[model samples]
Target chain A: MHIRVENLTHIYNQGTPLERTALHEVNLEIEAGERIGLVGPTGSGKSTLVQHLAGLLQPTTGRVLLAGTPIHSKGATARSLRLQVGLAFQYPEDQIFEQSVFREVAFGPRNLGLDETEVKARVHWALEMVGLDPARIGPRMPFTLSGGERRRVALASILAMRPRVLILDEPTAGQDPQGRRALWEKVGQWQQETGMTLIIVSHALEELARLVERVIALRAGRVVADGPTREVLSDARLLRDIGLDVPEPVALLQALRQAGKDVRTDRLLPAEAAAEIASAWGLRRAGA
Target chain B: MKAIPIGMYVPGDSILHRLDPRVKMGVTLVLMTIPFAIHSPWSYLTLSAFIATLVLLAGVPPRTLWRTLRTVFGIAFLMFFLYLFTTPGEPLLAVGPIALTWQGVLAAGGQIYRLCLLVITASLLTFTTSPMQLTHGLEAMLSPLERVRLPVRELAMVLTIALRFVPTLQEEIDKLAKAQRARGADFTGGPLRRARNLVPIFVPIFVSAFRRADELATAMDARGFRSTPHRTRMRRLHLGYRDLLAMLIVLGLVLTLIGLG
Candidate 1:
């Protein structure tokens, strides 16, 4: 679905002593099949904004428009909006309840009221997309799987729903470097195959750089910058002012440029950074 | 549903909050037993006033107390109706074969009132005392049970941990429920289907809770937590004049109510 958030404001524990605004007049639009990254420090309302997109939370002021319809409406219409927007939470293993992996993944499709054959097909496809061998993992209990496997199962359960838009919150949190890389690779592959609209929320800017086409940086519940990932990431001072670390590769390039070496500072990917640094060193050697 | 309010200890510095939890426990025990000792309207009224006063002094939100009572109101009303219709006395109102009597109505009202008092007093204790203090007080009170070969300290630790996990588990369940909703698991259908849908949310919660329990055990072990019969506490319990005066007042009220009615 084409998602648009307009003047969205969310206040948690409204009217209570703990009342605080989690999001303040935040506005953004995600075109169908558009891939975007939501980057912010902790408590910057990243999770709150995504939850509103899924219609799990009502906006205190303004509305979230899914496919050109206000999803913040009451009752059945809003619920239908929720089904079309799939949200995979961080540590989604905590949401897994089915005894077997197949049954767990089939939950969303089954809830969508699909036929048994269709549900099974969706579950199988989802498992395969996540790089899990469904025939091997289907019968085993979800609790028996390793942590990484369980996380994949959790993702597959949401993927089986085949939502028009997919929002993943910190999918790589608490993982080792290899696990994180593997998760992003699988996610990227799945996105390519399905062409689903994707919004990924993470604090790690570099991880999101190569994953998303556009980046929206938030701080203190307000959108500080929203533009192409490369342009937004090029401004190291703006990122630092919002309490976000400049991604390592970007910082390295900027350091070289400051030392009077000619190099591009906008490359955030490791491979591109390595190539740029190598070429820059070779040029410096020739000049010397 | 929102988070369960089983152990919602609202922090405050009221006299009731500062009183020794052992004394608070003693008062609750004594008040709970009073209904069994005396069955008079005046006694119930005195108990209600005592509870209301403690509730007021504790600085607990009246809304919180009322929220707790609201859940039990239906059951209490049912009890009242049962007593009103079943008891035999001079008939006051007749509807076909069913007759309502003044004595029966009064008896029902007293029963429900006493029930309310019991609930209010218990909630008052939990609202004023933190789980840690309550656990420490329980250990100190049950220390005497150690002479009878009971594992008093271990039992107290278990109770404290269990109380602590109620909120943690509640939050976990809430998140899982939201996740299920996001996946189009409707919990608002027919009773049977709703019950069936609960499996998806609950199974994960059970497994996660167990996993959390295991982690907690490992973490505690790593921290060198041992269940020694005697251990130094972070806060020591001392019965000062305030605790003694509160206990004496509750005791005096119970005695006066017993003698009068």
Candidate 2:
């Protein structure tokens, strides 16, 4: 699903002494089947913007156009909008509350008022999508699972909804290197199969560079930069200015440039960056 | 449950805010007894005037105070009808299946008035004091009971922590509800169904609360927190002359009401 946030502003606790503006006139459009990464520091309105996209929060001013229709508190659009967007929050514990993994993943499908056979089928399918075997993990309790396992189960619960726009907010949080890699790979595969519009919100640019093609960096509740992932993450000054840690490849390329070499910084992957430097050195030596 | 009006603290700089929270709590206890000693309309008026003056001295926004009092009025209104129908006394008239009596009418009005007064006194104490101040005040008041080998400090610590986590728990609950709602959980059903839906939220909350408590215990232990230690206070509670004068005036009023009754 395509999402258009036009002049969106969200002021928390409005008309009170403790009023605060969380999002300030944030305008963006996420095209269908687009893999976008939302990068920002804490309290920079990334969560607020995603919540607006997921229909969990209403805009204080302006409006959110999801699939070309305005969503009010009640009506046909708002009612059906909930299933169109799936948001897996930053904390796995926030979404994983069901006792059994089967019941947990089936929560969304059951809410759709599906028959038992369909609910079970979706639960099994979702579990497998997150790289968990349904036959073994279905009957077990989610709380009893390992940290990465619990995270995947929480994700599977949201994936069961089969949302057109899938949002994973720091889904690999607290995961080890191997676990994070596996989880992202599973997400990549699932998105490829379903062609869902993927928006991954993370502060880390390294993991995001591998996942999303487009990067939208938010600083102080405003979209500071929005472009291709390689183009956005390549600018070390932009990453540092936005208070985000520069990815390793971007940092390495910057160092190479500073060391008096003509290396391209727009390469996101470490291997691509190394190859770019080798090719640049080859061209330099050939000219010499 | 967005927020209970009674739990809300209205920030102000009036004498009530400056007064010791212990003294304010004591005044609440003293004011609660006035409802039991009512013998005539003069006493009610006196109590009302006295409560109103104290609220005025508190200097809290009247609109904020009214928001707190609204809940009390709702309870009192329901109690008025219950007392009118349930209490058996001198029959004054008949309303449908129930007989309206003179005693019942008097009882209903008096009880409603008394209920409203007690709530006002209690809410006044909370309105002017923050949770931290309230907890410290409670601890100071309960300190004397340590002579009986009571874990007063631990009890106070528990109270303080519970008060502190109320907002945290509320935030967690809001997040959990949002997460579930995003996945198509319906909370707008009947009360029973709403409650059933809330189970998913509460189970996670209880689990997280326990984990947080465990982590908090470790942090406190690392910081040399002892249950029965000599702890120094950063903001000590001192009773000023104003506190003494307030106590004297409240005592005098209670005594006067007693004598009149």
Candidate 3:
């Protein structure tokens, strides 16, 4: 589904002495089948904004529309609206509570009123999609698994719904190195197959740059930068000013330029940055 | 969710806020009880004036105080009307089933006045004192029980952790509920169905809470909590001149209230 956030502002615990504003007049449009990365410093309202888009939170002032219909409305449109956008929250592993992995992964499809056969099929597919073997893992209690495995189970629960939009909030936070890469690869493949809107929120800029073409940077609850991945990541100063690190390759290019090497800083790929740095130093030695 | 107004602390820099929590709590107890002795209008006026003065000195916004009062207004009215018909006296007016009596008017008026004073008095203590201060004060008050092997320190720590977890647990429940709702789990249903819906949220919360408790115990042990029997405070509570003055003033008011008869 196409998501639109218009003039959105959110305040937590409104009308109390402890009340705080988390988001302020924020706005963005997300097209279906688009891959986007949401990057921000801590307390920048990134999670709050995505929750509004998913219809988990009602806006304090403005509105969020899914496919041109308001998602927080009191009528029937909102009743089915939230189901279209699947939100895998931060620390999704903590959300698993079902008795068996089969029931756990089947939670979403069952809630969607699918038949038992369809639920079983979807659960099997989603578990395999997240790299879990359905036969070995499906019959066991969810609490008996490791944290990483349980997190995948929680993710499969959301995937069983087959939502048009999938939002992963720090989905690979505590994963091992290979586990992270494997999970991201699966997400990429799933989006390619389904052509769903995919938004990933993470602090790992290098992984984000590899996955998403569009990058939106937020700081202090406002959208400070929105552009293609290379363009946004290339602005090393802008990212650093907002207390976020640039991709490692982009950082290296900027460091070379800072040392008066006259190297290109707009490069995001590691091979390109290495080639640019070698040529700059090669020319410097010849001129010297 | 909005903060539960009556028990929530409103941060302020007032004389009442600086007073020791024990003294404030004691004064609240006294004020809350003195209403039982109040029957004459003069005594009620004195108590109302005293509470209003306390409210002014605390610099709490009138609107915030009104919220505390508004919550109990319905209960106060119910008690007032119940007293209006039940208490016997000369009949002022006769309705179909009940008679409004002159003595009933006095009795109900006094009951409502007393109930309001009790609520305001209790709310004032919490409004000026944080949960941490309250727990610490309770610990200090109960330290004497340690001589009898009552495990007072652990008791206080339990209370402190429970108080701290109130908000953390709230956030956790909110996150879990939202995650479930995202999976097309509708929360709307009849009573049994609603409870059944909550099972998905509450069961995980219970497991998480237990896991957190285990981790907390391990963490506390790692920090040398079990190595020493004696405990120390980062900031010790002291009874200063203000606490003594507040005690004397409330004591005088208590005497004044009792002597009104």
Worst 10 residues of 3 chain B by lDDT: B1-10
| Per-residue lDDT of candidate 3, residues B1-261 (tens digit) | 545546578899999999999898878888887788677778888989999999999988777888888999899989999999999889999988689999999889888878878888898988899999999888888879988989888888889999899888988988888889988777897999999999889998999899899999999988877723676789899999999999999889888878885
Query: Candidate 2, residues A117-191: lDDT per residue as tens digits?
Result: 999999999988989999999999887888888888888888888889999899888889999889888888988
What CA RMSD would you report for each candidate?
Answer: 2.9, 3.1, 3.5
Ranking by DockQ: 3, 2, 1
Which candidate achieves the best DockQ against the true structure? 3
A1-288 per-residue lDDT for model 3 (tens digits) = 888999999999787667889998998988888999999999998999889889988899999999999999887678677888999998898888889999998988998888999999999999988889999999999988998899899998898889889999988998999888988888898899889999999998878877898999888888999999889988988899889977888878777778887988878877667777878877433332
Q: Candidate 1 chain B TM? A: 0.92
Give me the candidate number with maximum lDDT: 3
Clashes of each: 0, 0, 0
User: What's the residue-level lDDT of B51 in candidate 1?
Assistant: 73
Candidate achieving higher DockQ, 1 or 2 = 2
The CAPRI class of candidate 2 is medium
Deviating ranges (above 4 Å) for candidate 1: A261-264, A271-288, B1-7, B35-46
Sort order, lDDT high to low = 3, 1, 2
- TM-score for the A chain of candidate 2: 0.94
By TM-score, the better pick of 2 and 3 is 3
**DockQ (CA atoms), all models:** 0.55, 0.59, 0.69
The 10-residue segment of model 2 chain B with minimum total lDDT is: B1-10
